[model samples]
Target: MKLIDHTPQSLADYTTAQVANLVPDGRHQALREAIGRHQDEALARTIACIDKVAAWRPGEFNYLHSSQYCQYLYYLANTIWVREKDAASATRLFLLNKALNGIDLFYEIAMPAHFFIGHSVGIVLAKATYGDYLVLYQNSTVGRHIDKIPTVGEGVIIYPNSAVIGASVVGDGCVVSQGARIVDRQVPPRSMAFTAPGGELALRPAPEDLLREYFRL
Candidate 1:
């Protein structure tokens, strides 16, 4: 993939610099080395992830793009956490991503391979069961209730101000509408979820075309 204004090594250096400035935990060397060691793999994984987003340019990564940068930072942090088992280094990257992107994604959460972050602001993601072709918009949440996490299926779009929590099972090709909540319910595949009168979950059939708005799948 083509990187805009940065090679892999330069991006690693730049990311480490950001962590040093923002986190300032005096572990710059460790984080720098960790990022340097894992940057190439992390960026290759990021390219695989971003290539699925229909809204983005194919085969090009622009660090100046806020949402793309957010995704890359998450992959870098996740790679360090999973491969190096270095929580300190990973945590710094997570914090730096939150600071710069206004998103609250932690390092421990295991996201799917190909998901899209439409906007990065105020999106708090829990360690829920995410699937490929997932779309998370600004102010959207995927959280747990009383330790019961959500299961979001493939080809799903969680629009702005929407949430699926508390053991909710969202099926494939579902669209959680704006300002809707699906709490402990099972939404059928290829359905759209919204709030019925008096705060009940309502469903209607949805087209796969809706999900294609955000993903190429």
Candidate 2:
């Protein structure tokens, strides 16, 4: 799917089809074509970032691995190239924009076949290993440091301002406290993770009963 091979007008039409499930607008096709014709030069840096991240994964080649990471970068690059104001890089962007306003789906990122989000903003997800029903609040980060990947279990609630870094596994039904920081550790299920003194981490019953509030059906 080389985008440059097609005419700018045709590329716009194709982009509309690709994102129609998220944003359905008859004029979006024309808008996309105009952006391609006018903004191709401006989107070069983002395109480079996408290409760089696409080939740098450590996992084996398979649908689960590639679709979750590599293909995401491809879609992200093209989406941002077409829409320059937003920083969203996946499906979450579309849903978020749809929720924020009645406007078309804008910028977002989300894994395929993942849990639903009623609303989202300011969320950052890294290339960490994740299980089902992973709910995240705004400003949460699942990231790495010194060549380590985080492993997140099912039904985890990462609250706002929380960060889970380095190699760690947050077990099922856990709640990471708002403004909490995690690094290089394994957390038990149904537990509460919070930040302790000296930037360390501690566990206790989640304040406000976060697990029951966010994870329970």
Candidate 3:
């Protein structure tokens, strides 16, 4: 007997109105307000971000999966607008993110665009500065240790059940391996942090050698 695949078509085939329907009702009002506040060109840029995320999959698309990217888009836009002191619009998106994404990400957290939150459940991001293209998986944390917060660089991948805590600086092209813990240490760029023989943390140079398959290069 042959099995059949029942996956939905790619979201790239849908219209803007159809894509917008995937967002929750509560978020729609806030999204419209946020888009309205921006100029026409800026609005187009924001839509482009949404489209980019929507078209990520190679073939079939699922609304349940793609909707998370929409949540990320709102959260990123909210962070940018909040930095410009648009309190009302920012609050709306913040509330929407909390309600939809189930992540305890504060509005003060400086997460720029192109940051992906995979499995948003159990992920906590404090008031830390995040560079572009940061990918965070479930059960991973980025928070303060004492008075200092982490400064994460671009293209840093924090895998599941891992963390970068305190005033640590995670350099570009670094991968925090799953179940690894990095606290208050500067991880050099293009390196990998993993568990040593005695369960201690060790950094391996040139993570791309081992971790290239896990992240987008």
Candidate 4:
């Protein structure tokens, strides 16, 4: 079924009906409940983020209706709602993500606005902080070590089956290669971190120079 056929020019052009149709059929009520939890400012921010993502991917109409990105939108909205002290709504969205995406993401985790979850399944983000435009793939883990946690920067992409743990700092525009393990280290901006044969991480310039052209840097 076609959920969203046209892209709105702005958030003001988006109607509740359109949003309702975009969400999964059985999840409409939950989406409404979660949106209802947002106050004026948080609601505005959430709407803006939705609009921004839609505008960012204008050609991909399915992106709006995809369960993966939809769950991300809900999580982003819940983060704003929780910051505004709307605990009930936050908890509901968190549970909804777990139920729909099958991932464990705590509501207290700091997921900033404009962050992107490429694929939601098997992803864990228990980091200290996440910057804007972050992209997380499936089967990736961003955990912590003891009391210290990883701090990710803007436009960072963590590929599938990769893990970034411990007091690590990932700079802006850094790409963690698939299956790489980064712990207790720092990655420079616009660099790529990949695992060597001996399981040691090697840092080099990002393979694709056009990454900034595709992602927000």
TM-score of each: 0.96, 0.48, 0.68, 0.71
| Cα displacement (Å) at residue 102, model 2 | 17
Please say which candidate is ahead in lDDT: 1 or 2: 1
Model 4 residue 177 CA deviation in Å: 0.1
Worst-scoring 10-residue span by lDDT in model 1: 208-217
User: C-alpha displacement of 6 in model 4, angstroms?
Assistant: 12
Residue lDDT tens for model 2, 2-107: 2334543554454445455455644354445444554444234333322323232322222223222233233444356356543333343344233443223223
lDDT of 3 by residue, 1-217 (tens): 1101321122222312332555444444544544444423333434333434423442222345534444443544555475466665455545555556666776566566556666777788888888876777888899897898898888788889998899899998888899999899999998889989899999887545433343333
By summed lDDT, which 10 consecutive residues of candidate 2 come out lowest? 59-68
Report the C-alpha lDDT of model 1 over 1-217, residue by residue, as the tens digit: 8999998888878888888888776889898889888988888888998787888888899999999899999999999999979999988889899999989998888888898888889899999988888888899988899889999998888999998888999999899999998889999999999889898878999865887677776
TM-score of structure candidate 2: 0.48
Query: In candidate 2, which residue pairs clash?
Result: 90-108, 90-109, 92-108, 93-107, 93-108
Residue 103 C-alpha lDDT in model 2: 25
Which ranges of candidate 1 are over 4 A from the true structure? none
Global lDDT scores for all candidate models: 0.88, 0.54, 0.62, 0.65
Better of 3 and 4 by TM-score: 4
Model 3 ranges off by over 4 Å: 1-35, 39-80, 209-217
C-alpha lDDT of residue 217 in model 1: 66
